[model samples]
Target: MSSLHTLLVIASLVIGGMAGMLYQKRRNEAENIKLNKTAEDIMSRARKEADEIVKEGKLESKDLVYKGKQELDREVKEKKKELSQQEKRLIQKEEAIDNKMSSIEKKEEQVARKNQEAEDKLKSVDKVREEAENLRNNMINEIEKIATMTREEAKQLLVSELLEDAKIEAARELREIEEQTKSEADKKARSIIATAVQRCAPEYVGEISVSVVNLPNDEMKGRIIGREGRNIRTFESVTGVDIIVDDTPEAVILSSYDPYRREIAKMTLERLITDGRIHPARIEELQDKCKQELDKHVLEVGEQTLFDLGVHGVHKEITKLIGRLKYRTSYGQNVLGHSIEVARICGTMAAELGLNEKIAKRAGLLHDIGKAIDYESEGSHTEIGLEVAKKYKEDWRVLNAIASHHGEEEFKCVESVLVQSADAISASRPGARREVLESYLKRLENLEEIANSFDGVSKCYAIQAGREVRIVVEPDKVNDERLVTLSKDISKKIEEELTYPGQIRVTVIREARSVGYAK
Candidate 1:
């Protein structure tokens, strides 16, 4: 009984569970059908909306195409209208050209007719002229036969007489003109030169290649000589100067060809003497210090020169070179003093002559700059000066003055002329330069020789310290006309062959005497 009950209960539970499963499956199937219907409806609506959107897009595209075509057509019509207007203008221009061509052709025909008429008139005139020329020639031949001279001979005789008369008149006029002009020119030149000299009175100190330094005692000399002369040798080698310590009481001589080197040695010796420390190392140290001091001194000197001249804008190197002139000498005259004198003279003369005084003075101050470096340079002072001026980009007028101050170049302006005259005045002043006896004698001899070399010169005398040469010419050999020419020739020969300062005045004397005895 208990097993039957248990079996029946299990069978019931199984059947009930199967029924519940079938119910759950039926509910799931109904839910799946509902989800499928809802999905199908959503897909149908989406398709309808998409179809409508595509139709709208097609319609919009067709409208845009139609509008674009219409705009294109309108543009084409406008272009056609513009082209037709241009064509009309071209047709009008062509018609106008045709009319101009017709007018030009008519004018050409008229010009051709006129040209023909002119040719005929020219031909007739030529015939008449030929006939007249023949008649004239016949008349000339008749006249020549009667006169017993050809036309050319008559012309030559007339020309000869006219030439002789002209020469006499020309000579008389030239003599009078020269006498008048020379008198005025000489007076003016004297006045200018005298004024320039009077205004500028520069003090000059003669410089030599030896510098003497006074010592406290002779013991200092021995000390300067140092052990084994090492100190002296080192100083000399460094300074490029020789120290001559002889029995000169209490003085030592620093000798060198270069004034700058001599100066350096002098300074170095003075410092070493004062410090009382004499050795190679001390000597070099003091030498370096002295060089620095000298450089400062050089720059100060340059600045002072420029300030004195009232010049500005000089290159640094040029200013240094100018200062170097302070230690330079020419013919025993201080170059700096001479240059200052020249600058003053140039300024004065320029003021008097209505020229640029500053430019004149500037050129005058720098004219001898070449002499500063002439020892190291290969050319003449003028050439070196020209190069220096060019290097510094100096004014062209200043360059001209520098180059032509020695007459090495042609004067380019009145300022150059003024600078040249100033230089001459400064260099040629009394006591400005010292010429050795030998050179002076040689120069005088050369002057006389040059004068005597020319023909018609009977005798010549170089007077006024060779500043002037008076030549006696043979009156038979040189006439009054040739006297002027002979003087010029002798002057030219002197200029070309001789080298001298200042200028040479050539005077040719031709005197004719008729000797007669009244008995």
Candidate 2:
């Protein structure tokens, strides 16, 4: 029974095994089918994607080609437009060039035609000139033949006659011109002088040869005299001035020809009196100190004078000389005052005459600079002044003015003449200078004597303060022509023989009268 049971179990086991095997086989087959389906779907999707990709690529390529073709056409069209514009511009430029060439050709043609006309005109003129010249020659020849003389001889005769006629006409014209010019010149000169004089108003300097120092009391005089008169002697020796203690109340007189020395002496004495210290050493000390102070003062004065006159750049020595002029006198007029007056007058006249006022003023101021040293020097003021000016390398015009102011040299410039004129104006003004009675009378007498010494003078008189001389000439001896000659001779003689300020006028009168039968 166990065997049979075992057999049955075995059989059941085999059936179950078979069943399991079949189930397993069926599962395998289903899995294989699912895998095949999944593979097929994946392959189908890949093919569809590849085909879409190919279609998009072809469309993109076509669009790209179409865009490229459009761009090329646009570029070609722009190129054509640019080429057309260039062509148009070339045409316009060609037309303008052609117009300019035609205009230039026209101008050249006109120029050629005008040149031909000018050549023809020149030829005609040459022909006319030749004909005129030939006619003139023929006329000259005929005249020479008719006159029974050669050409040169007839020319000489005609020239001589013409010369005589010209002389008379020229003389008449010259006389008229002289009269008119003299009148105008006199009027103009008077106007200018009057204007200048009106413009300048300077104070007149009083002439004082000695300096008077006032004292506090007469007792001071004895103190100045000192013991044994040694102090006065020392003062005089050191200062080169004379001290006069006289009855003049409370004043002592200081006298010296050298005003500069007198001024120093005055300063020293006044200082000594003020300080109440009087001695030989003290006097000399004060004198030297005063001299130094005066020298410094002199330079300051020169600088001030230059500033006042608008003049500059004088040498230091020359400036001192200029300051020294303050103490000097000319014809009893203060030299410095006179120089200042002359400078002002010169400046005024120079302004009116349109000259350099500074140069004129400078020349005027320094005109009498030599008078400062004339006492110490050997020559005349003019000569010494010239030497000093040249030494200082003054302007040529200034030198000329200085040299010619007194007629020692000829005037080289208008400024020089103005300087002389101003100097004369300053010196000749009323009360500007002092003259002795003897000299004044002698000058007038000499002037009359000079006029009388002339041959044709019947009577003569020096009038107008000896500025003018009138002469009555013998009618038979001096004709109108001779009157001119005699007047010039008298003037020349006066100029040579006289030393006078300003100018002298010589007038000659020639009159012829017939005896009247009316009685």
Candidate 3:
């Protein structure tokens, strides 16, 4: 029984096992089918989403391509418009160039036509000139034959006549030129000279070789002569001046050839007389002191003269020499006074003529410097002055003025000429020189004789103290045109024949009178 029960149990266990297997298998199959369906749904959804994304991408791409094409078309249109404008400008420039070329060609053709016309006119003119020249030559030959003279002789006669006519015409032209020049120059020159003369008015003193010192009494004269003339001897020995205690009242005369010594002697004697100590020792002491004072006074005068002249940078020796001029005399005029007057006149004229007044004045002042020592010097004042000036390293212009003021040398500068002119004006003024009546009259006669010697002069008169000659010209012989030449001739003759101071003015008067009665 137990074995049978065990077998049934085993069979039941087997069937249950098979049933559990089938149940597990069916569950696994259902799970697999559900998993398959889920996969299919997910794949379908993914494909739909991908298709929509592709369609949207295609639309965006198409829109971008359209925008790009529209932008490209706008740029291409702008390029075409710019190219059209450039083509129009090029066409206008080509038209302008063509017009300019046509105008230039027309002008060139016109020039060529004018050139051809000018050439034709030149040919006609050459033919006419040749015909005229031949006619003139024929006329000349006929004239020579009719005159019964050779061609050379006829030519010579004609040339002589032409030369004579030309001389007259040249003379007329020269006179006109001279008149014009004189008319212009005379006005200014006269003004300058007149002004200079009017401005300079120096005092004229008749300086003599002797100086008179008035004594207190006749008793003072004897004191000056002292005992045995010891005081007078010492004074003359030291001062080199002769003291003349004469019978001319209470005055004693100091005589000396050297003005410097005379002046010092005068001062020394005057001081000795005032002090009442007229002795040999006192006389000499006073003389030496007076000499030193006079020397110092000379320097003062020099410095004062330069200061008055507004001159500077003068050498001391030159200044001393200038002071010495105060004691020196030329003719009857004081050399210092004459020099100062010359300086003033020169300065005035120089100012008017627009030159350096300082240089002119300096030259004038130093012009007669040698006259200061001319008594002691071996040469003329000009030579001595020139040597001194060269030694002092004066200006070359100044040196020339010093050398040539007396007309010994040629002038090197305008200022030198002015210096000479000033010197002449000073030396030639009225009462400047001591001329005898005989010589003065002789000079006037000589001047008139010189003027009358000219052929065309009808009458002449020397006036203004021989400074000017006025001539009456024969109108027939010397026409108004020839008067200038005649006057110049007379003046040249006067210059060549006579020796006169300053300048002589020649005045030629030509008068033509035709009188008719109205009744």
Candidate 4:
């Protein structure tokens, strides 16, 4: 029984220990439950946080997608806008070009309309003119019919009479033309001659063959001879004047072509003889004295010429120069005298014709003034005279006359032409002047050249100082038709080619004389 009891106490002790351990374990388990609760709450919180994170991620994703879509839409709109603007610009450019084209087409249409209008007007006018012409012809026909028979018959009868009248009218027309031309030519010629003759007056040239050098006595001849003619030889060589020591007592002869030089030499010899000197120095002295005397005489002569000419307003220097004209000759006529005659004629003619006498007179005076110094001037006499007149304060018209007097220039004024005519008249008068042999031959040669230019012309001769050109045509070659043509042609050619005093009559003859055999 004791053993059983110990066993039961041991069991109870063991139970008590087990029960305490169980209680402790239960408490620990409750603490563990609370800890588990806390753990669960932490886990729930973590789950919620995770859920919130997912929601936040979804929201961000949605926002990003929306922003991307919006950006995509905005890009589409920008592209559309650009395209629209480009299309609009293209339309605008096309419209502008179309507008320009339309404007150009309108302008072209307007021009065409104007051209059509002008053409229509011209056609209308042409129709009116045609109608007028027709009406005129019809009127002429009706008027003829009213006179008597049929229109053609009456017109023919009237036309026959009219044709006869027209023949006479034609003849009168040509005759009237001839008369008018002649009258005009005469008037022009008269005008020219009148002007030239009025202005100039010149000294006439006289024959002076012998120039006398009077000696004081017969004893002076011995001094002049110098015992061997040495003085005479020296004098002749120095002066170019022939010293004729002759038996005619107390007088010596001076001969030379140049009359001024002869006079100078004569004066020189007279001075030497009077001075009674025989040396070369004395000869020179006498020559100088003679030259001085000649100068004075020349001036005196010029003054005298001016007085004789009735010319005034000349410079003294010019007057002195004009004095030299007394020694000058043109075609063997005294140039000074010719000038004077021309001046007088021009003056007289101008007075009669009621023209400018002063201009005429001036022109006539200076017309031949160039010849005075023409050799020294080295130009045409007309040109020289022109220059001289210009220098002498002459009128421009007078200068023109001086130049045109020789056809050196075209005559500007009537006075210029007048001067030329008077000069021609004065020169052309019988024995007015002489022509050189060479000139005569050359004139004949020119005549031949002129005649030979004509077809079938055989020969030509210039006679009476080119006053006539006789043309002989070959009878076999020149027909009557050709003869008339040749005559007209020759006359026209002569008129163009020749410069002479008077109108040259071109005589063209065509003789058809056959040389038959004697048998």
Candidate 5:
């Protein structure tokens, strides 16, 4: 019974354990089924949410596509509108171009027709001219036969008679015209000249190249001529001037051909006389100082001249040359003063004549620039003035005025003529220039002699202050042609033999005598 009971217990235990394991496996299967069901439900819920999200995204994509389509349609409409406008503009331009082309074609046709008509008219004119020429030749032949003289001889005889008659008639007419014009012209010219002269009257003074310095005493001369004249020699050599220590009470003369040098020497000597330092070193120092001062003064004078003339834009070099005219003289008249007078006269005349006043004044002011450099340069003042004008690149009119003022060149304009006239007036004005009385008398005598030397001149008189020579020719010896020839010869001889400022007028007078005593 104990063995059996033990066996039963073992069997019961095996069966109980098998039963427990079976129960545990069944519970595990039940839990696995619950977990799988939960998993399925969760997957179904996730799938529904995903489906809703995909639907929403599809709707949004459809809306976006619709908006994009609307925008593309609007852009297409605008493009079409722009293309239509461009086409319309192109059509209008094409139509206008075509119209212009048609108008040009019509004009060309009209011109062609007119050209053809002109050609026809020219042809008719040529035909008429041929016929007229034939008629003229026939008439000439008939006239030659009737007259019993050759055409050339007849022509010569007719021409001679016509010339004689024409000459007398022309002379009468010319005299009448001259008389008529001369009065008006003379009055106008006199008014202009008088007004110009009255307006611009410069002071008349003779400019000399010598500078006179007053000394403290005659003893100063001794000191100046120190130690065998060493001081005087040194001063002369340094200053390029002659220091004359003559017996002229209390004055010494500083002489130099160059006015600038003389001025420098004068200033140096004056400083030396004042400072009581008369030595070579002090002279050189003072000379240098005086030169600087003189340079400043020259520029100032140049500026003042331009200012007075109301002229601007002159080259500095030209202005400097103008200033140097202050020291230059022509026939004892100050060149600078004469230039200023000429400028004023030119300005006044230009105003009256309706020309550029500034340019006229500028030309007049610079007309004598060559004289300023004539000592250094080798040419007449006119030629030198031309060179200066060219160097400074002045206007062509100004250059012409300068070159022609002295008759060295041809007048290019009326302004040049005016300049010449003004120059003559200024130079020939009384008291404006001076010459030795002996020279003046010699010139007049020479003029009379020149006129007398000409053939057929019975008597000659130099009148108008030697500016004119009147000749009384014998009518028997001199015909009208011969009188003109004689006058020309006399004028030529005077030009070749005499040198006078301005020009001399040669007048030949011939009077025929038909005095039969009518008792």
Candidate 6:
């Protein structure tokens, strides 16, 4: 305790003196902490005031820091709210876009399936058509017994053989198909003729009335009879006509099958009555003069008409004979008018079928040329016409047409067939020529009345010049099977009750065509 304590006391005194000096230095350093001059100028205050301001600034800093921190917190909260709203809106937009995309994808898939189905159906249809074509070719090849024969040859021979049989069978099987099919086929064929007729309506729709003369005074007619009455006999013999003095107002009765002869006789009688000269010499002179004039006029008219029709290479004598047809009537119909109408109809129909329209027209025009010569020839009109056409240097097709019009020979070309069809159509068309007016009306009325007499029949149209009768039945009253029965019944009734030309077809129409809209 004596030495250790003495050394500790000396060390403590020395350490205490150093501590005091350090304390003094710290105090002086503390005093040196004045306001920075730069701060004083920036803050615009004295040094002491700057110091106070610094202290106040430190307090204000604390408050400002706290306020700033609160504002930052509020901003972060608002930003989060905005971000949440934006996220919600983005999610809705994404969902809407996805729905639209899904809908488009579904539509695309459906379209793809439908397209594939359509393509498959088209491929199947093509395959079926090809197979049917091949089968037809093979079958045709087998029929001719000549393995090397082409399909065309085999088909031609088969057609030639089956034509007659098919015609009979088709007539028999008219009731074997649905009435709709029959009606459609009839309509197609009728449409061709009707359209041709209607489109090219002939300009001449007029008819002529025959003239019969009556004497002005019956007493004068007896005086005109010479002694022994040889004058009347000679007059009749020279004129080739019958002269009758009837109780007429101011005319003499003139009757003759030949209008030209009747006209000549009428003119001669008028000249005798005017000049008071009734003698055989005068009669002979008048007859010769009238004959010459008539001949000349007939020739001129014939030549003019032939030129107008553009008929080529007609013999002068043939043209004169053709002109003579103007005076003649076939059952009260104008043969020339019939021929022209036939030509027009044939041309139009042939054009529609992509055939030679000019040839068809030419054939049709010449079809009745034989009728002009038939009066002098021995054969039928068809044969005469064929020979005449050939004599006139007509085409072979035209010659065939003329020959085949009355079924005198087989048609060689399609144009011949068309001409025949046109001729038949023209002859059969309403108002084309005169028939027994009473019989025609009676037949038409009978056709309708007969159809109406059948059960389940609502209406009937006599078509194809009474060749066919289309009967309509109430859909509710008659079903498809009964429609066929009704048609058969009506056809039987027509045969039993009505008199008609050619064969009469009884058609019953039943239709079912569906219409729909795509979604």
Error of 5 at 230 (Å): 1.9
Question: What's the lDDT for candidate 1?
Answer: 0.89
For residues 1-519, write the lDDT of model 1, one tens digit per residue: 999999999999999999999999999999999999999999999999999999999999999999999999999999999999999999999999999999999999999999999999999999999999999999999999999999999999999999999999999999999999999988987887788889998766667778899999989988999999999999999999999889899999989877876787889999999999999999999999998898789888999999988989999988988888888888778888898899999888888767788998899999999988898899988899889999999999999999988777899888888787787677765566766678888999999988888888899998866777999999998989999888888888888999987578798999888999999
Q: Give each model's whole-structure lDDT.
A: 0.89, 0.89, 0.88, 0.77, 0.88, 0.75
Candidate 6, residues 166-220, lDDT tens digits: the string is 8888876875666869888788778888788887666434434335544445555
Model 1: per-residue Cα lDDT at residue 268: 91
Evaluate model 6: give its lDDT.
0.75
Q: Over all chains combined, what TM-score does candidate 3 have?
A: 0.58
- Top candidate when judged by lDDT against the true structure: 2
With a 3 Å backbone cut-off (N, CA, C), the pairs that clash in candidate 6 are 214-251, 214-252, 215-251, 215-252, 216-250, 216-251, 370-385
The TM-score of predicted model 1 comes to: 0.62
Could you estimate the TM-score for every candidate? 0.62, 0.65, 0.58, 0.49, 0.64, 0.49
* Native-to-model Cα distance after best TM-score fit, residue 37 in candidate 3, in Å: 70
TM match of model 2 to true structure: 0.65
Model 4 C-alpha lDDT per residue in residues 149-222, reported as the tens digit of each score:
67678778889999999999999999999999999988976665545444444433444545888878888877
- Could you tell me how far off, in angstroms, the CA of residue 204 lies in candidate 1 after the best superposition? 2.5
- Output the lDDT of residue 234, model 3: 85
Report the candidate with higher TM-score, 3 versus 6.
3
Least well predicted 10-residue stretch by lDDT in candidate 6: 203-212
Off by over 4 Å in 2: 1-147, 215-223, 245-250, 436-446, 449-519
Give me the displacement of residue 310 in model 3, in angstroms: 1.2
State in Å the error of residue 282, model 1. 1.7
Worst 10 residues of 3 by lDDT: 428-437
Q: How would you encode candidate 2's per-residue C-alpha lDDT over 457-491 as one tens digit per residue? A: 89999885676799998998888888878888999
- Give per-residue lDDT, candidate 3, residue 345: 90
Per model, state how many residue pairs clash: 0, 0, 0, 19, 0, 7
